[model samples]
Target: IMHLPFRGRLKLLVASLTAIILLTWLYLLAGNLENGRSLLLSPCLSETPEARVLERVVLESRVREMEEENRQIRLQLNQLQGTVGQPADGGNYGNAAWGASADTGPEDVENTAEERANHTECPRSPTILKCELIHVACVCAGHNASRDVVTLVKSILFHRRNPLHFHFITDAVANQILSSLFQSWMVPSVQVSFYDADELKSEVSWIPNKHYSGIYGLMKLTLTKALPSDLTKVIVLDTDITFATDIAELWAIFRKFTDKQVIGLVENQSDWYLGNLWKNHKPWPALGRGFNTGVILLYLERLRRIGWEQMWRLTAERELMSMLSTSLADQDIFNAFIKQNPVLVHQLPCFWNVQLSDHTRSEQCYTEVSDLKVIHWNSPKKLRVKNKHVEFFRNLYLTFLEYDGNLLRRELFGCPSQATSESVRLQGALEELDEDDQCYDFRRERITVHRVHLYFLQYEYTPAGDDTDVTLVAQLSMDRLQMLEAICKHWEGPISLALYMSDAEAQQFLRYAQASEVLKNRKNVGYHIVYKEGQFYPVNLVRNVALRNANTPYVFLADVDFLPMYGLYDYLRHFLSILQLGCNVTKCYVKKSRVLNTFQKHCMQSSSKLLLTHLYTSLSPCRPRYHVWTKGHAPTNYAKWRTATTPYKVEWEADFEPYVVVKRDCPEYDQRFVGFGWNKVSHIMELDAQEYDLMVLPNAFMIHMPHAPSFDISKFRSSPGYRYCLQTLKEEFHQDLSRKYGAAALKYLTAQRNI
Candidate 1:
């Protein structure tokens, strides 16, 4: 009905035409819009353009999938961080990326192990790889030396954690046989090289081991021909002996110094040279002084550069001629060298490379060393060898190693695959059960075998006249008897007990004592009737008597003034057990009065009430003395004592009261008691001579009974002026002995009860 105007009349016709065109255009547009909607809704595309659009959609979907995987990995990393308390790569992303590259699988780990086993060396070394190389060399001229050299090598190689190569330069080619036997075993980090006569260059032109002109000639062959010139450094050992401990620690000590080329393990053996020399040209510098050359660290490079080889050759020629004319050998030349070159060497610990002769020929010798690195048996042709005492040498030999046919092999190389060390077995002796024999009841028969046996010898006498106060004396006697009874009742069979009297007037007392069921036929209990013309030191007489009478493994001297308790046995047994375990000596201590006093002050409070109160009052008569005792309080400075336990406690009770005085400078005392007092104290204190196996046990009763007549103090009143003389002796000599000897003298005194 509407007409588009084309200017009035024209509008009518244009309107009609416009209307027709609009209607037609509208219909066509509707059709095209519907087709587009259908194409957008359809799952399948027909045109190339639609397919191209679908490809774009597929690529976007793939990108979203990759993003999801990355998110999962990040979540896993966070979870791992929570568990390990650290980042997966130990921190930063750079390390993590690198770690990812190398982490193939466990199969790769196995392959690497196989490669190592099959002789493939890896170029990529581990960052933590460490090297510990030790070179050992020894000179062997004959017989047992080959065996000893092998043993030392074995000991070192057995302990080595890193690879070690041992080169032995011996005149005896037979050593290669021994070396081959050792090498045949399944051991890592070890190699053996033998330098025989055929390998060496001899200036003298002699057949190596059969007959060297002398010691110098032998040394010359070793220096000039046998040893390698390129050998930079090495530990040189002598033949013979075994090790009691590890040598690696000694080696480490040498390694700590940059200038360790000429160090040697030293012993107190050098000190004995003074007596040996008898002023023979001042004993060869190091000869009577410092290190022993038996065990040495030679810087082969330095040695060669210094012309040591040439020097030795020239010296050998001269010494060989001199020896043929004068009968002296290598020691003289060595002595001269030692004097000339004093600063070239350093002395190591005594335990390393010790000479067996140090324990044998030297006075005050120490037979037991805690750890042995090397052993030098340097005396086949010397005076000590000529004067060899088999018993002494046998004991020394037994002490160093767990003996067997293979002990030589074990000492030098370490135990064979089947051999086990017996240190634990020896230590187990402290226990009351035999590990070897399950059927043996060690508790009943040999219990406390290593415990110290304390003895207190006592004698009784009634003064001739009743002119003096006898109550103190009688009371003292009863107290002594009660203390002895208490100790006997408590310790019983573990300790030895004895009583002696010179006067037959006390025959009834003796008869009753001898008849007493406790004393009759008892192994540890006995009585003696000694008839002496005049008064003598009771302790000295008793000790001499006990040494003769007792057959027990050990004995200690007890004073009559001490009252022993049952706990003493247990304490001492435990203490000695630890010492035996550590291969050390247990020191016996008299429980101190001052320490007990401190216990009474702080511990005796109602809240902390302990047995210290009763122990202090009961054990006071024992007269324990410690340097810690102070006048202010009982010296409670028990910390000064070498306690067996970490948190220490005072054990034995001792009295400050002096024992009987022996007359000094008296021929009888010295002649009768050779090992008593000063001599004994000196020997016990000797750093060299002392046997650490013996220990003083604190647990048993070292009970002192002042009332007991261990000494006939009544004789002091009867003899008048003799009282002052004897009192002076008691105060000066006996007290001094007590202070110096401590409990060691008690062990000897305990012997008196046996007498």
Candidate 2:
């Protein structure tokens, strides 16, 4: 700068200084803008080798400082938000700070505190997007509790994938234990809270106490009020239960209930309800009417609509209470309520709540444990002991507690690794027992005739001569000896009689045959006695054995008590001869049959056709009978009988009995069926399964004798063993047929009867 006046010199110096300052500021701003652009382009910072080395050296210290800062910020935030105070009962429902949602408001905060004070617990706010929230409840308060709350919780956690909020209604001691256990476990998405049963008792004080044990029966009644009001549905489980499948599957049952159905439960599998609770109640079976409440899906909204308090009040009403048994207090009341309003109940599959003890007693109804969703240890003995089924479940319970992933997978989802071999052996042994017990005899004992006996006093015999192509097979038991004598004497064709008896009966029959003068003279009659030891009379097996012995192409499966009329054998021989000559007939049955009681000798004396016509006319009020041969004076008119044989099509399930005539090569009778109920039914069902055609004879019939019904037949409905055997045989028949012909076999067997 140039020398000037003092004022001008001062002004120039100030201007120069101000320009320098402004220029410096612009340069710094440009540099900062470039750095910002770089940062935006390169999101991840790149460091030089020296910078990386410096970072590695101070990483731990820097992390500590950052964590401390975060902790201070969280502490400040928590202080501002206010601490979630402990519940009044000293039980923490969940991690409150971590579970509080962003949507939580001041009202929600106040409500949460109030809920804690009221001793009512709520689930944590759902964190995961689209995750389903399921609420489950259970009561554990009794001296007989073999399983602790931990085992029950573990079972639920092991199987469920969706978020679960468990409400454990229990005593104070169990509440503390469960709260601590759940806190220590800290399972994600699974929050549990313990509700004191005392709280439940206080809330439901209006309910009349029927001296009910603890809160076992009453907890379910108060569930609508006890659980958080936000929940719409909850699955109620017994503490004795162990889950085998995802509880979400059970929770989904709420979706299936109709508008009118308030609860979904399984029927009691055993007759315990029928025998003990129902007693003499009509319109209800022992097993089907009552539902087992071990596992129930409660629709809280629907239950509330029905007035939960009203249910409690009904228990106090003597007239209504008397309709139920106090033995199963809540269960009986629920069943009685359902009985009056049947539409309020939806029956779940028995697989959901299988009563192990009940299934064990009736092994026929036993479902394998692997297939079940929940196994209820109803029997106290089962929990305490190490039996075949009980031991495996106990070990599984322990594995769940340990959280042994590998062992739990093997025991829970898969079959128990340890039980595999034992189960296989047990299964094999059971199959062997089933085989041995199914028929008259398991041992293939030789059948031999001790003597040949016959009675031909009222006979007109026309021998078959050289045409010995037809044979009659009849199965005889203790009561049909006279009927057998008449059949053997009257039939003029080849006959094979299978005397199905025990050893003692065979000895008596042999002596009786040897002393008979009529039997020794008849060359056409032959007797084969099969001796066996069994509780049930295997009539079908004997019939099959007798048919197998016949050498003829055509065989007649006749009842030993039925006497073929005069021209039956002649008509059958002609029919078979025609069939053998390409008539395309597989079976033929008599359209008209006569049943002669002990006092009705006139039926046997009259013309078979005339006898049927007279009987049909005499019994005017009764509809004409078909398919079954009953012991009565009922008959079919000759015109109707003749009209019935007018080339009608024979369905697989046609009522025509196999007693008429059939090809020897037809499907043999199933021998697995035991006792008298299914002897004839099984044979007919099999014939139907095989799609064989049966025709009715136009002008022929047989007369059944007047022997008294056996003890097995008369007491069939009253006997348990008999009923069991009947049901077992029916299942076996369906299974055998289905195995061979697929499920369509059942349709074939049940087709409409005609011809």
Leading candidate by lDDT: 2
Model 1 Cα lDDT, one tens digit per residue, 394-467: 44444432222122222333322322233334336546455565323212222211111122112222322321
The parts of candidate 1 lying over 4 Å away from their true place are 1-131, 141-143, 148-150, 171-176, 198-201, 204-217, 220-225, 256-287, 314-331, 358-368, 371-373, 379-755
Q: Judged by TM-score, which candidate is best?
A: 2
Q: Which stretches of candidate 2 lie over 4 Å from their true place?
A: 1-431, 434-468, 582-602, 619-640, 644-648, 654-658, 748-755
Scored against the true structure, residue 700 in model 2 reaches a CA lDDT of 61
lDDT of 2 by residue, 1-755 (tens): 56798899999999999889856644443334331232222234325664344334345445576679968976775563232221112222211222233444555456456544554345332232235777888886532241244456667777766777788887754554455435423345665767778877865454444534544566677788878877788889877777878787777666645565687777665555555535563322222336778888888887888885576456435434444334554666566565554456666666677666533332222346576667777765655643456666666655554442222222322212233343455446555553445431321211111111121111123445444367787877877886656776667677777776643465467567667776646555555544444455656667766777566766777777667777677777775555446433432332211111111223466556655557646643222222234312122233445346442333433333445466677777776655556566667667656655545555566665656767667657577766766666566667777899887785644543211
Give model 1's TM-score versus the native structure: 0.31
- On the 0 to 100 scale, the lDDT of residue 615 in model 2 is 62
Cα deviation at 596, candidate 1, in Å, is 88
Candidate 1: residue 166 lDDT (0-100): 68
Model 1: how far residue 724 lies from native, Å: 95
Tell me the deviation in Å of residue 353 in model 1: 3.2
- List per-prediction Cα lDDT, in the order shown: 0.39, 0.56
